[model samples]
Target: MRPYWCVAVAAGVLLVSACGAAGSGAAGSGGPVKLAFVYATSSQNPFQEMAFGAKAAAADIGGVDLALSAPTGINGPQEVTQFLSTIHNSKDGVALETLTPDLFVRPLNQAADLNVPVVAVDTAPPAGTKVGLFIGNSNTELGKALGEEFVKQVPADATGEVVLGNDIPGLGLLQQRLDGMRSVIKAKRPGLTISGPFDSGSEPTSNFNNWNDIVKAHANAIAYLGVGAQDAVSLALIQKNTGRKFLAGSCDPDTSALQAVKDGYVFALASPEHWLKGYVALRLLAERAKSGKALPTGWWNTGSLVVNSANIDQIIARQHDEGSRKAAFKAETDRQLANPSGYLRPLAEAN
Candidate 1:
């Protein structure tokens, strides 16, 4: 068994490290390489899926001790504190999701000063941050795909409103999703008017209520699209409760959202491949730690999934449990290792 110390902090942080070894030299001596994968928040679906992938990577690539954590809620300062503390402790390497890039400038630059390999996941790093690479879905493309699904479901000549809700109005990723969907709808269905990318709070109950209000107000909308994880299930719930026929689409394939797609309530789901991002981020760090390989510089597009009636069953089967999900993506991970250039792209072209 790998000798290590795993500490669980009350601040919702989990830090793991190999005992009695300098992280930089650990891999050289075949000792455990410690890593920290921190997300935006704890107990959320997307982040939990990411954690699953990170754990799988740590296990599959022996001698890797991975620690993961995030804030209990949407607290930027708390997340920053976790990031800074992890940076100070995790000497092998660190990977993180910087939703609010501003909060990470100091810690990211500090990591750079310490010669630690840093990879940003789920969000691209800001201009001044010292992130080696980014790994996540192309948010704009995901939105365009969701919009295409909406367009396919609507009538050819239908001219009506398409209501959109954003759980976090100012978030760059959500805004990009809204913009992408808007671009698609305008190009294909100019006759269809787009409504507000309203601030539907990220909290589940409020998210549902906000969508409920939007639907009740625009009962005749051609389609309702959500740019947040909660949007899929909320819109589906609203549709099922009121028997509304408005075509509904949203992002992420959470359990309820997948069921929504399978039940014919939601038109389609845009899956950002949360697990792949986590797995790839941790795997990259492990490779660098063990083999002295340089982490690729640029955006590594983990890609996305458009879950609909056609392939919902396969998606559902893979997500049944952590083991099933890891097993499902093993070949893809191998493919990534076999050809890195295929997925890695310049930072500017990440969109």
Candidate 2:
């Protein structure tokens, strides 16, 4: 029916198609497994970085199509809504940052009923959610680390003020961090006077204003625990207003915050290995999906590292030259993965 040349070309195309289908069949011997990563908000750089890392890691693994999405805002209810939508849309597996576990538990269970592996990253879901795994640092341990670093920097005899700037008042993770720091401070240094566990509010501008007012009122304060990006803005404001420096610590890192660490404006930053968190979450989901096994229960604390002035220069240089904070993240990830049992423990167990 066709010319000789055309017939030969058609035969070749058919052969190639057959071989490709066979290869795909061998690769996905179990079933089709899709992965979706949903974040609290696309606007925050931290969540965006996590999404990027997850997508990149998924690319490394065969038979994975990573769909990274996020809500428009940081509201917990909105996060829950986005997560539920993602679960409904996902055909295979899903990974999400758990801002409000209570809100998402029932929906997550419904996904689990459909045999979709669900992993929580960045924040732990509510207890008894049957979540596959939690891949992030112990928030309380991070808080304690910040407190210890602050105490180390402040003068022992100085009975100065210390303030903790918390962005989310009701969040369990934030409360755990504050408690961890407060407990350590109470145990180690009874002389240090702690001030208002001031609510920094969610918005950056609100945090900036709150910190500005706090710094003005308590000029003698020696330390602050900033829980979010506004921490950097607060540090900048402090430098502008007081003309004096105090030990500044934060739960996470930002470009400006890292720069502050380099400039000696920030005393310490507890940088979590979020890249590894994303990678592990995806890898675990992929493995579980392939094996037809239920996802592992309990939390997997990925871990965090404290970066200070002594090592800030190297961190900054790595950030500037190599890539988007991947080097530091890789180092931390390697360390934790190498000794998972040693470092990856619950907050209560960490102490």
Clashes of each: 0, 0
Candidate 1 lDDT score at position 153: 86
lDDT of 1 by residue, 47-146 (tens): 8888888877776665666778788777888888887888777778988985687788887898899987889999888878768699988999999999
TM-score of each: 0.93, 0.82
Candidate 2 positional error at 216, Å? 2.5
C-alpha RMSD by candidate, in order: 3.0, 8.4
Error of 1 at 98 (Å): 2.6
Clashes of 2: 0
Candidate 1: regions farther than 4 A off: 1-10, 15-25
Q: Whose lDDT is greatest here?
A: 1
Sequence-dependent TM-score of model 1: 0.93
